[model samples]
Target chain A: MRQLIVFTLAILVSTTFKVYSQEIRIVNYDQLDKLVSSTKDSVVVVNFWATTCKPCLEELPYFAEAGKVNKNEPVKFLFVSMDFTSKKEKAAEVFSKYNLPGKCVLLSENPNNWINKFNPQWGGDIPYTFLQDKKGNRTHYPKTFATSEELINLIKKELIKQ
Target chain B: MKHLLAILFLFIVSISIAQTTGYKPGDKAIDFSLKNIDGKNVSLKNYNDAKGYIVVFTCNHCPYAKAYESRIEELNQKYASKGYPVIAINPNDPVAYPEDSYENMQKNAAEKHFTFPYLLDETQNVAKTYGALKTPHVYILKKVNNELIVKYVGAIDDNTESAKDVKKKYAENALNELLQDKTVKEPETKAIGCGIKWKKN
Candidate 1:
């Protein structure tokens, strides 16, 4: 029984490590929108960023920290990269360097044709974020960057409302 | 002290008044004297022979800006003889993006063989006052009654990724309309671009 318990623990540890070191996925805007809209019972925090955007790069650690602290909570943080399809590898390298939490998706679309569709308030700028409850209600934060405390409060506020 | 306060209040009032809606169509554009790549000051006032100006806020590193660099040059080549000239400005802070520095600006201009005046808004005051939110932002200004009036604002065209596939030429159309003595039907547009690199205070 002790051996069996040890075996089970080892399996769990291996799986967790595998997940931690997993490579991020590259997804188009349609696939991203579908995944984000399908999540249930969670407060979704979606951040639009790019590898070249200095402010976006600087603010990822805050989101990662918030996600780590709220690992067990019904809060989801998704990073939607605005990098090109050809730069998928570069974007992945940046994401791995930061070890950002949750799923990071690369939006391989012409931003010119798609900026307004994300939100009318979006001025096609990076570091734009959106907070949403399980009910699909959304709040847009069209700023350059946000703090972990600000993100936590936003998530908590949305969770409470749910 | 009272005199100082009065001057301060007037300064604040003038700034607020000049920044009204930020150069919408029919609004008079604020002229600026910024340093050009040739190490000389240039301004709308200096373009005495120009009928209009394509004031583009762009930089060296932003992909969108790079994509439009040739097109902007083409704009000046195509229209400057017709009395409209392209005036490009780099508003990005060099501290945030070193590739957008003044030296790089000169290198990019040299490599691209830019005919237009590529200027530097080192303080970024012009960008802020114009309410420019992103790189590659365009403001088409027309000369009317000895004043430069903003005729169109926004993207150069509808497509940033592919110039050939573009269906609408927003800035070009506006200029063409102005040349024909007609008002622009679509005076504004928004395109995806790198946000301006602002200096950290």
Candidate 2:
């Protein structure tokens, strides 16, 4: 009886840990495209950030809060990390530490080849947020520090217009 | 009426912010006197004898900037004698990022043995005027008949990760073209680097 109880407790703990530990998806451009195109008639907030960027860290919580607030809304938040492939572990650790909401993925694409694809005028800087509509058409791509309210308002404006 | 005025004011502010998205190719470079690491003020006008200038907006803490430090030094070593001297500047706010402070700039200049004038853009006007979005951003300005012309604006090369892997030396090529009295083939290119730490309003 004692052995059975111990085995059951161990099994429960392992399962709980496995469920709680969210795996950070390491994705190429093709995978990123798939994720961006997954949902229809939804406002997607694709935030390009990294562990090394201080401004990114400062605003990420606010961004997470925005995601949580708009959970029921026709909004989808994607935290795409621009950290190097070598810092995959570090990026994952930061993601967990921040408890960043929604789908979290590390983009492994070489920026030189794809920076302009996202936006022609994009200078490949962090703390950049790309707000897109249901059809994957970009509504706003602010390449600077943006507050949660500003992000939400942008989304709302787009949603109303569309 | 008050609400309408507030909305109008907000609209104007937004318009101004949109206007600051920064300099494109062919825009005349804004000249300013920024303090160099050597405790002397430097300006584009000071380089009257030079044919052109390789203005690089970079900082200490940025890994990409550090990566290109050697290449920047070599650029100065080769070009400063050849009329197109490298003029590096730190356009980041020190309070937002302490590593970008003037003192750190001096230390970095000494430690790295930089041959060019490493200036501190305290106001960041020069950087904004040039549309410098990231560290290690380059703007190759040519001196033509006492007027400065923005010949090229872009990255030092295609690869910022490794200097050896650089296939296209964009800035170098532009300078070479200028030296040969020819038009620069590519006017602008983008690079991946740390964003310039702007001070809060």
Candidate 3:
């Protein structure tokens, strides 16, 4: 009887470990919609990045740090990786390697139309950023990564307006 | 009648000078000695036996270029034997992205077994001269009557990812046109690639 119980316990532990280790699939547009809707009271910071883009890689840590610092606040950070489908698995490896945080997701959509759907102001550039307030008022900053101070000031200004 | 003839002559001279801003169709491309991955000079004039050149602006790290690496190699293999060889140039500032560093360029070349010379544009002068905006951008030139004239300038194809989905092959068609002495059907097209990471001011 004790052997049976031990086996069962081991099975449960291994199952839970497997579940936790599974890579999260964030390609669903529905998930993104839900995130935006639920975080309506807070500001949403969306950063478009890719595993191969060096500027995107450099700026991601700043967003991660920003999320941690604002853990007690109402800011919702999303790191949308723009890596191609062919590189999806590779991107996952890179994400784990970097120990990325703050809701990492791989963008899944027809890439040709993605830029227009996201923001017309965006020039289809990597490391692009979009900020949305609780009211759904959106502002797109279509460029490379921002310095910590630049990021902080932008957030502070948004918070002040709120 | 004499005054009208002089005016016509002056207008022709003005048009000729305006057309010489850089290389155009039917212009002999001036050769330049540029450093390659091995720190050795590679010049267009080196291929004395070649009929023309295919100058492509590409780099080691851009996703678009990475996607088209094999296809570009295929082009070099197919055409180099036919006389028009590919001469690739890396125009991105190495300071902005270390992977674009000359060291990484050599590494990428060896690892990928690149068939053509991958030259570095030290000052981005060549890129500026050609108005190349993105990686994998192509400029096909041919020597017609001893003048290096631009045959075509654009993306390799309409689809950067795959030929299966390609609606058109710009470079291939241009080469075919050049071979037949016919005007390229599509002379220019936009390319999608990583933006050249210029050093921040």
Runs of candidate 3 with Cα error greater than 4 angstroms are A1-41, A96-101, A108-110, A116-125, B1-55, B62-64, B78-85, B95-99, B103-115, B128-134, B137-195
Interface RMSD, every prediction, one decimal place = 2.4, 1.8, 3.8
| Ordered list by DockQ, greatest first | 1, 2, 3
Docking class of 1: acceptable
What TM-score should be assigned to candidate 1?
0.82
Could you give candidate 1's per-residue lDDT for residues A38-117 as a string of tens digits? 99888899988888777888889888888887888889888887776567778788888886777788776555556667
Off-target runs (Cα >4 Å) in candidate 1 are: A1-34, A108-114, B1-21
Model 3 residue B198 CA deviation (Å) reads 2.8
Worst window of 10 by summed lDDT in candidate 1 chain A: A107-116
Q: What does DockQ give for each predicted structure?
A: 0.42, 0.42, 0.13
Q: Write the per-residue lDDT of candidate 2 for residues B1-201, one digit (tens) a residue.
A: 999999999999976774566766676777779999989999988886899889999999887788899999999998889899999999999998899999999999999899899999998878876778888898888887777788888788877766777788888898898899988888888767788988778
Candidate number of the best TM-score: 2
**lDDT (0 to 1) per candidate:** 0.83, 0.82, 0.74
Best candidate, lDDT: 1
lDDT of 3 by residue, B8-41 (tens): 9999997665443344444445566789988899
lDDT by residue for model 1 (B1-201), tens? 999999999999988866544566777788899999999999898988989888999999998788888889988988889888999999999998999999999999999999899999999989988878788999998888888888888889876767887788888888888888898998877777788878877
RMSD for each model, in Å, please? 6.0, 5.4, 8.7
Runs in model 2 lying further than 4 Å from the true structure: A1-31, A108-112, A143-147, A156-162, B1-21
Which prediction has more favorable lDDT, 1 or 2? 1
Residue A65 C-alpha lDDT in model 1: 82
